[model samples]
Every structure is written in C-alpha cells, then in structure tokens.
Target: MRRAPTQKRSRDRVENILKAACELISASGSDTMKMGELAEKAGVSIGSLYQYFPDKASIIHALAERYNEESQHCLDEALADVTTQSGLIAAFDQLIDTYYDLFLAEPVICDIWTGTQADKTLRDMELEVSRANAQSLVRTILRLRDNDGDGATFAARCLLIMYTGEATMRLAISVPASEGREIISSYKRMMGRELSEMLQV
Candidate 1:
C-alpha cells in the first residue's frame, strides 16, 4: 500500500477495495481488472482507492500477501501435532487438503499463482514464504527424528518438497474437480512414499 490505513473506516474501505478486486479478478482474470472499475465495485472514489493501492500491481501484491498469510496459517495448523513419520504424512495430507479447498473456495488463487511466476517481486515474496515453511518443516522433522545429517541439507530437501507440492497443487487446481481429486491423490501417494523412504534414511 502507498500508505497504510490507520483509521478503522480507512481500513474497512481498503478491505472493500481488496474484496472487490478479488471478485473481479476471480470472475474475469486480472488482465481485465481496471482501477476505475474496481473503485466503482468497491463503492469508493478512484482517488480513495489510489490512496491505498497506487496501481494494479500494488493491488495484486496485496492480494498475494493475503493469500500467503492464509496459506502459512493453514500449514502451521496442519503441522502443529506432527511428531512421527505417520504424523508427518497425516500433516501433509491435511496441508494438501487445506490448499485444495482454499483454491476451490478462492478463485483469485489461480491468478495469484500464475502472477507470482511472472512478477519478480511476487516471486521473491513466494520464495521467502517457502523458505519460512521449509524451516518450519525442518524443525518439525528434527523434533520427530534423531539424525546427524547437516541441518541445511535437510532444510533444502524440505524446500524441494514444498516447491514440488506447490507446483503439483497449481496443476491440480487447474483441472476439473474429479480430475483434481485424482491428481491430489496421486500426489499424496507419491509424497507419502518419498517421505516414508526419507524416514528410513
């Protein structure tokens, strides 16, 4: 945002703007979303909208941040009780289910996922979020298992899992619901096999 909304009313207006933008983008991809249209949908003046988000990219960035925050919360909750190999697999299952449901519920996620790949700023933000998640996974693994392996190496492996899972999720979300389920099921099976093998090593 160009300036953070300090007042309650200001914050509400910004929220409306973001909500309107997401609805618009969800209905008709981000490329067609204009600031004037967004302002009208948000029931705010164009100047008022500009006060919080200077441009389209800023609005998209804010939306991306929101998505990232929600995803982080889901991951944290899913990992909260993980302390064994089976628990880790179950945690991953919950995480994947949460993401799949989120994508279905929030159509804006499709745009955000694609946008991050093309925008450097968004991509960097994505990597930062991934690294944080990887660290969280690393800590969980160490707490559950006794290993003398390099911590950084384990973290890097966790990062790989996160990225691959995300990529598979993107693809899963892009297909029909039935096909998406099958895709996620296959993904979980593959991940379960890999993680089970890792536990043995």
Candidate 2:
C-alpha cells in the first residue's frame, strides 16, 4: 500500500533562530549578531536561543554545517555526468560555474562564510569543510587521469591544492564576473596540462 504524501518537515523554532542569526551576521557581520536582536528577529525568547545554542559560536557552527552540506550536494550533482578527462573537465567547469553562481546568487551567505572577524570557531569549521571538498575534487581528478598508478594519490593531493587555491584567489579579489570566468579557464587549462604531465600521459 502507498503511504499518503507527507509534507516537508517544518523547521523548529531553534532552526528559525539559527537562520535569523546567519542572516543578521551576513548583513552586519558577527559583531552585529546580538542575542537580544536575534531572539527578537526569530520570534523566540532569549532563553529559547540558549536552549539550542549556548553562544553565538555554536550558532555559527550550525550555519557552517548547513552551508557545507548544501555545497556538497551541489558538487556531487555536478560531477554525476563525469566519465572521462574531457567529461571531467566539463564537469569541473560546471562545478566551478555552479559554485560561483551560488556565491553571487547570495552574497550575504557568502559573506557569512568569507567574512573575517571574531569568528575563530566558524573559520576553523570553514577550513575543515573546505579541505574535505578539496580532497574530494582531487580524488575525482585522479580517477579520470589517462594514465595512473600508485602515484595517483600524490597527484590528487597536488590537484586539490591547486584547484582550491584557485577558488580561494577568486573569492579574495573582487573581479568582475566575466574576468573571473577567464581566470578560472586559465587555471583549469594550466592544471590540465600539469596533470597530464604528472600522469605521464
């Protein structure tokens, strides 16, 4: 027997608080995320905020988790069409395009991730998530190599650093979107040649 269609899970009040906190943080930054303001915006009591997260740091960490999970989902979907180097290149390009699109699509959210201030916990969480993403992209690149051996691991590590560095550079500077696309293309071309050599293709 088929079950009736179920509605999506309604977000809890704590979730609403976290969402409000992130929006406020992105707009004005971590310094502006006052608990009082957050509680007011989330339509919850200060005690309720504490019930979910003892401090702002905990709230930011939860936001980071949500961001990374969403990004991972997009990347996984982008790579699904990959099957060869050319296909991989196309997939990588799509992945990058999707990433930048996401960033521009919501500058506020990107600011939350990219902002630098009294956010030691959020910064650490961001680095940890980014490292995992770099490693995953690298592993996929190595698998698509025309020639490979045990050395693929080293090559994967190198690709991870290069690709991640490129992405970081793009984020750091305020280049026009078109120029940014050119930069990414150049980086990809260079990395492709370099990877081809490393794999001795």
Candidate 3:
C-alpha cells in the first residue's frame, strides 16, 4: 500500500475498493481484473485507489489479510471456551467445518488462495501466519498438559498439523462437493487422532 488510510472517509474508500475488487474477482478471476474497472465500480477516483493500494497484488494481499484475520477471530473464539480434551477436539471439528463453509461461500477467497500458489511473497506470508496459528495451538496443548516444559515435540507436531490442515482444506475444496466433504471428514478423523494423544485424557 502506498499510504495507509487514516481518516474514516479514506478507510471507507479503501473498503469500497476492496469490495469492488472482490466482486470482480468473483465474477471473473483476479488475474484479469483491471484497476480502472475497480475504481469505476468503487465510485472512487483512480488516484484514490492507487493511493491506498499501489497495485492489484497489494489489494489482493489486503483481502487475504482480512480473510485470515476473520479466521483467526474464529480460532480465538474456539480457544476461549476449550479447556478439556473433548472440548478441544470439538473446537477443531467446528473450526474445520466453519472454514470449509467459508471457502464454499467466498469465491473471491478461493481465487486469491489459488493465486498464492504462484506468488512466492503470498506463500511466505501464509506460512508465517500458519506458524503463528500453530503457536496458539501449541500453547493450548501445553495448558492441557499442565503447562509441561514447552513440549518441543508438541510444538513441532502442532506446526505439522497446522500445515496439514491448510493442505487438506485446499485439496478438499477442489473436488466435487460430495467428494470434497468426504475428504474433510477423513481429515477431521485423522486430526482427532493426532490431537487426542497429545493432551491428557
């Protein structure tokens, strides 16, 4: 972004730009979307759009950040009430289902995620976010283990689980709905097994 939106009006303009971009992305794909079209759709001047976001990738990156932030909020909510092993497992199941539904509902997110595969910068951002999320899970697991000594093994396993969960979601959303749902189900089962043993019974 060339300049961060500071005032309320600027922030609203930024939101409008992103909203227009998302609509365009859903209608076509982000690859073919043009800045002029986004500016026109957003009812903002092209200069204003460029002021907030220098290019298409930055706009898409903002969208990715927003989506991830929302997902993180869901994870935080799930974390808040989960103290026991079964609660943790149920939270994981709920989060998986929530994300699956989110991906299904948000076509723009799907397109942006697909673009990340080809963009090294976006891919690295995703990996960094995954590590941060994994640390949250690791901490929760440690609490379950009575705050046992940092649990290096658990830390590594949590990171692997986080990576696998993302991979599973990407794969699950690619197939037909029936098969995609089955794939998610299988992942939930596998994840349950992975998480169950890591915590106290």
- Model 1 over residues 95-181: C-alpha lDDT tens digits? 888788878888798888866678999878888888888887877777666754467877888888888777887888878999999
Q: What tens digits encode model 3's per-residue C-alpha lDDT throughout 1-201?
A: 789888998888888898899999999989899999999999988888888889999999999999888877778778876879999999999899989888889899888786778888888878877887788888888888788645788878888888788878788778899998999999899989988888843
Candidate number that wins on lDDT, 2 or 3: 3
TM-score, each model? Answer: 0.91, 0.73, 0.95
Compute the lDDT for candidate 1: 0.85
Off by over 4 Å in 3: none
The lDDT for every candidate, in the order shown, is 0.85, 0.63, 0.86
Positional deviation of residue 13's Cα in model 1 after best superposition, in angstroms: 1.5
Off by over 4 Å in 2: 1-11, 116-120, 145-147, 155-159, 162-179, 195-201
Q: Judged by lDDT against the true structure, how good is candidate 2?
A: 0.63
Best first by TM-score, ranked: 3, 1, 2
For model 2, which pairs clash?
Answer: none
Ranking by lDDT: 3, 1, 2
